[model samples]
Target: MASREAPSPASRGVSANKPLPPTFKSIQDVLNGEGVAKGTLVSVIGVVRDLRRPIPTRNSGGSNHGRGPARRADQSSLTANIDWKCVMTLCDKSIDDENTAQNGATGIELHLFCPQNAMPEVGFRDVVLIKSAKVQDYRFGTSLLSNYRTAIYVYSASAIPMPPKSAKDALKPRPGSKASHVEDDEHEYVSWMYHSMNKDSLPEADVFEEQANRSLNVRDKFSLLKDVGDGGFYDLIVEVIKDPYDLLDKATVWVTDYTENKHFYHHSWDISNAESGRDGDPYGYTTAFENPTTKGWPGPYGKQCLQLTCYEPHASPLRSQVRAGGYIRLRNLQIKYGRNGGNLEGYLREDRAYPSRLGFDVIQKSEFTEDADSRLKDLLKRKLEYKKKLKQQKEAFAGLENTKAVGAKRKDNGESATKPNAKQRRKIQRAQRDQEVQKEKTQKAESLGLNKQVRCESEDQPVSSFDRILNGVSWRRTRENGEEEHLALPFTNIKFRANVRVVDFRPRRLEDFAAGRKMSEYDCLEDYDGGSASGSDGQSETLDSFAGPKTWEWRFALELEDASPKAKGEKPERIWALVDNIEAQQLVNLDAVDLQANQEQLSQLREQLFKLWGNLEECKRHEYDAHLESIRRTKLHMPPPDSSDNEIEENGPEQAGRRPPDKVSNKPFTCCLQQYGLEISEADPTKCDSGEGKRYQRVFKIFGTAVR
Candidate 1:
């Protein structure tokens, strides 16, 4: 048996107010004693993995797995390979969750046994709880702690002495019951006690070096205590230090800047009120990190890390197969640091789990090596590029913001700028387009009869009246199903006429307007007071001489007032704002002549293209047009071929009708017709009726336009 020996806080680089208990003690007498025997309480830290007891798989309207029938199966399967050893490893994990462990048939009863003289004197058995990390497969639970192994420790008892009775039982003769001790009487009893309490012999520094390796073997950070004499390292098992810091979890790993030391001990190793030999350290051992020359080692700086242990279940009463949800693996583990008892402060070294048991190859790898400056430079460059991209995005967003704000201001200044307050107008126009898109998405989804419920989000923006005012558009409100007010064209006044003759003309009916006019008819250009036609005459006009556009004398006479006017002797500003659901007066009426004229220009222009592209956009736009014109010109420039002249010679006399309405070749006609869907007839001898040929003529008429 071993007894704990720890230096006082003053000796260690810490200020521990409470005395640390011994780390090791014997459990023999307690096993036989009548009183409550204290078992070492292990500090188990990990995420919670659900306890599963495998039941028959029952299909509940999910996916079908097995072949044969569409019928359901028993879906109550415990999907995971549980490690039964972990369950058996603990002597008894207290029933923290009564509902989960006590009555639940699925949850297990934990079994635990600890080193007697542990940090808490003797760990509290009833209060202890062991949780397995959910994802124990190749990740968190199993992989995270795979390289690690548990270390059992033994020491003589002092405060709570053993009963001294169980020791005599092993030597007792079997009462008609077969009994043969594993070893000699006293020695066998003590040895058996140790064996029963712990499975393997205590680990040593040099022995650990021989055994521990990265790939072949792993060292458990939880192994035995380390010595201190080797430059505050090799005295007794461990040294106690006081710091409020605590926990080595992912979120806390990078709490502070990384230190030079790698391998570190946990704070739980501290034994309150413990004392050892004159060396003062509870225990001591050398890590594989010893330097050949100085016997001291250096560690990585700023490389933060933590011990993340995940437990896997080999077999559980609940989970016999593997499941994705069976275990949850923790990520981003780090050592905690800071004023609040952080995990970083408790560690003596990191990297190798059990630094004391390090081997040769591991030590070689553990030694600090030259940093690849080039890689670091590359990393820095990548980080910089990422930051630059983020900044560019932010700047673009800012530009958009400014544009939006400028547009709003421009819209508000309705009568000032002749630019049509286009920015605000476009913004409002986009809202309509957005609404259309949302409607289409919804309708398509509904048509498919699938539940793709998407909410149409209307922009929460201030409405702008730019289109209604400067664009000279009108609105008529009709109550549709008495729910929404629909705005249509024709007239409805939001701003009452009070000298509303600022417009060119005002007409009540659509037919009352004349031809070739947009809003000119609705505008009132004649001045009521000044008998001037209010029309722009050929003569130059001065501001004072002109009394603005004539006023519309409405039946409802209202005093006119300017909402906002420029300072005296300054140009008046334009203003615009959006009204949500109000009837508006329309200026332009829809007409076929206007639509036809607009379409004609577009149709004619469609036949044209600029061979000299001004920019990337124009190059894309004019590519086809340019190609057609070039082909026609090339054909015209070609010399007449002798073979093709046979057609004219066979005709004998020149026949006017034989021209065949400027007939084009079948190949060219087919190409043109196929491309533009135009059909050519032989009726007219000089012209083609198919709109495409006419457009091709127009393209030829224009220098920069296409021919085909």
Candidate 2:
């Protein structure tokens, strides 16, 4: 929704308050016996930012109200305004060091440094909130320990709730009404949160906790932060607003009892700002917005913001690129979350060599079934190929062999009796064997379909892709079974790393279609980024820019980081990345055993489909047989009677009378039913019939609709 508040009409604007520079602060820095009054309310807005000497008493500035600069140096803390009443309440009331741990809004609040007169003399529920905040210069020793605490400030104001109003409208005190204290509209409650710490009592222990091995979801991941510390390590979250004037001084409150909010993150609270950070309250600190909406999540774990205090160089960027490293680590990282859920966890491992293709086999163990039929099909294929080659060789030498045998017999001139008998028997036996083999081949071919004559009688049989592979060259490999096996592995036969280069390609048109689409190729060249994904596992990266296939240099050899490599002095890299094919890459990640399982599963699926097709063919064959048998019997039974003719004769006449004339014949008919061998029905020479239905529908069932 668009904001309801209009822009400020004032031509001249006050220079917003200056932010405190980075410096150590003590507890005494937030406390003052000087600004205290009985029942004085304070609202929390901005953080009680850094500790620095005040900005030289505001440069002795003129008020722009026609007055010159004041002589005395004014000492004040910085303050920002807030919209929610709940934040004001928390900041105003929770400044006491004891209350800091219990306050709902963690370290994010607005702070003001002003005197008692800031509140109008009602000691009231709603008063004018403090317009400015003063930051105190924090130095070491006694004050340093005190500054370790989190503080809030509140402005005193009368809150007579009538209805929820705009942040702009809510700033104005309702005129003439002494107070707004409607019981239903006013809600105040608080809850306590206890932060657990490590055995060392310091807040810097194992922050990246893997709940049963680092949680795969955001909620589960963040839950580990609680164990970081038990002491007063505050996670201060600052929500940003564009201009500070938009939120300057409003009355707000906070109850000791907190109403639970579902959206709290790492002690960050979402309370109404009017009550929690309003002026008259005692405890709120000030933090300023560097940008319009200084939106940020806690970095790493338990880190509310980048601790400029810990940073050696204040100007360093959040991200950097390094040429070569064992593992590039992010000490602290905050991931964004959306309305529904977090980003899905998906892992991609690419081959450094080839980019276009991948090798894959499904690894659903329970879903796999043994493929007995595919094995059988392959067996049959081998047999057919062997028989074909044998026949070809036999024809090539057929006549020559007979001539030589006959000539030898003649040369022997009435050869030995035993020889003649042996020759005759051998010829007969050879012929008989050939006939038997041919018969078997014919039967096998016939069994392949729903009908007979699957193989052509006069034409040629077309060789399929499957048949070509079976008859052509094949590669074999030795498996773990101590037996030779057939394998179609692309990497085993073809070049991998040297012949290929992995390039992450994205479609250019995708960005045009989607404005927010990420529009660049991601670097997916393997080297596992040198195990950069999961830290160093003794794995170093090998950077090899390949020239051609199988020509990788020995100097850049990658070896196992953990286990010693086959070659010494080689960098350790993921072999999974060396693979060029996608499926092969996945198989490598899953390991060799998984690869076999996947192939087996695919083979099983192939077998199941083959079996199903076989069963369907058998069923269809039986159906055709039954259909043919009926016609044959009808023709055989009566020299004149055909079974297909009788049923149609009666049904055809009835349907034909109602349907429109046929387009071809110009005669109304529902069908022109014809039988292959059966005699035509005598009643209606032209067969036509429609199924039973209402008159209009059944009338034109053959051509379906007769709209006219």
Candidate 3:
């Protein structure tokens, strides 16, 4: 039988403060002793040869696979209990590599089981020091299982510190695990193993390289998550529902293509803990709901999402590149049943042996071209339907609540006599406060007396309000389900004439209204010096004398507030419209130049803006200075600079009003506002960080209208 080697006489009777020497069993003895004792606790030290990705040992939900028929109120509820399992193969020095193992060398597998958050990270070729691992017989061979007392320490080959330096600095405990400590005597063995492994180039590295290249040629047919079956490999295009949670060797992300599968775990929000018989509910109950796994689960609820565990090379990219709400195409996703055989989950592993021909380029954007692919279109369609269904469910639940409240009310008094619960009362209070706030904002910006002060270029056109321009004009189309849907073409060549007041302007400072023109399309304007007009603006004057090129252009944005009366329940609307060089020159009636260098043009520009917005600039400057002073006082750890305009108004009738009111007069004027989509990124084949760049963000622009 395999036994732990004893400590030498010199090692014994050491200092009481020091840890005792560790005893490790050999591989041969541990396997041979398996028959003599079924479950044996033994510690071993070996070189890690291979690693397998973590898999969920338990399903996310209880045994009721929610499918076929709607679950009744009396039906047994489902609860989630998820655990993780990871496996790795360890071999003695007698077996150098897998090639030698084929010649009949021995190795034992170690199975580690813990909760997802508690799982430790072990990687390939590291020397592992496992203490008190329980040995058991499995499939005609011996394997080790981790217990509560089992601790693991890793001595990485590339990171091990050499003598006379202590290995204590180099040893690291597996992340998320409370493993046993390494004794002082064990440092020499660990260092020796590290040096010996690095003495010669291992065959495993070359083997992995060749296998990775081979993996690039293999391909699989694309299949939706709903159609995927157990033990099958298929490619999937999915939208990540939540941000990925990363561990040492793997990453976990929840994703869905908005498809339904019968075998998927059901997430419920109506079950109670007493009914489900689950105790210590650490995730706790959401009101009356017993959803332990999905307490704050973002919607498209029920069985729509699948949990995916990604291993190694793929995990790195998934952590760095992917984000919530982004779409990705996962290659060769293996669908398999969990250890309990009750639920289906996804495993994205990078197999070192017999790799796929396509290699580690498995994770990429679903739409990798300039245009959306057919599959991506289908995914979007399904996502829309899912959103509609979720909305209907919320509406139905709200209607039911209203009906209950009405039925319970005292009609004799024509009032809701039934008192609301704490949660319901808070919800009602929030809604009422929001409505009042919106009403105040809209009333403060109404255009009653200032209409005649300013005029627009397009005087004959009927004026629209900012709200009308924002909600946009849309047309109806029939969906596949025979439901009519209102679709808005966001970037259509459409223009609207609206009456608005300039409440704010961007580039913050008036002197930063112009910027250096880009030399080429590829120039990102990174060298523009952020409109700081000191050195660059003066230097540009010198360059223009010789270069004979237009060096500056106007680039700024204006925040416009609606000047019309807001309808009931309608919030105040504000939109920022970019004023490019061409439109800007027309508005101010002045050609572009270095505004800082020419004081006359700068003063004229200010006069033009004063006509457009009255004393709005003075009010803005006052507010900006006050904010800066407040920040400065905060940095100095002093009390705020007193402003009677804020304190007297906010502190109520008790406080004396000493500060003068702000002089702000913004005249309402009509303008031609055009709605368009701005290309945020240009399509470049060289960059693959995101999808083939067809990314366009909606933007509004001020055009045609000028200061007359």
As for lDDT, the candidate ahead, 1 or 3, is 3
Q: How far is candidate 1 from the true structure (C-alpha RMSD, Å)?
A: 31.7
TM-score of 2: 0.16
The alpha-carbon lDDT assigned to residue 481 of candidate 2 equals 82
Q: lDDT score, residue 513, model 1?
A: 24
- Error in Å for residue 266 of model 3: 66
lDDT of 1 at 155: 23
Give the alpha carbon lDDT tens digit for every residue of 1-708 in model 1.
454444433454333222111221111111222232322222222112221111111122221111111111111122132111112112211222223233222212232111112211112111111222111112111111110122222122222122223233322222121122222233323322222221122333344334322223211121121111112211111111111111222101111112123333321212232222111111221122222233111111122222222121211211222221121111112223323332222222332532221110001111111221222223223323433554555556657346577768856967465555554587689779856754544343333321111111222322221222233333323354655453332222332110010111113221222223222211221211212222312346566443533222111111111122123675432322111101011111111232233565333322221111112223322343445545765889954435335335323347422422221111100000000122344455445433334411110000111122
- State in Å the error of residue 674, model 2: 46
Worst 10 residues of 1 by lDDT: 666-675
State model 1's lDDT: 0.24
Candidate 2 wrongly placed segments (more than 4 Å): 1-92, 95-467, 472-708
> How high is the CA lDDT of each candidate model?
0.24, 0.23, 0.61
Which of the numbered candidates is closest to the native, going by highest lDDT? 3
TM-scores, all models, native as reference: 0.17, 0.16, 0.30
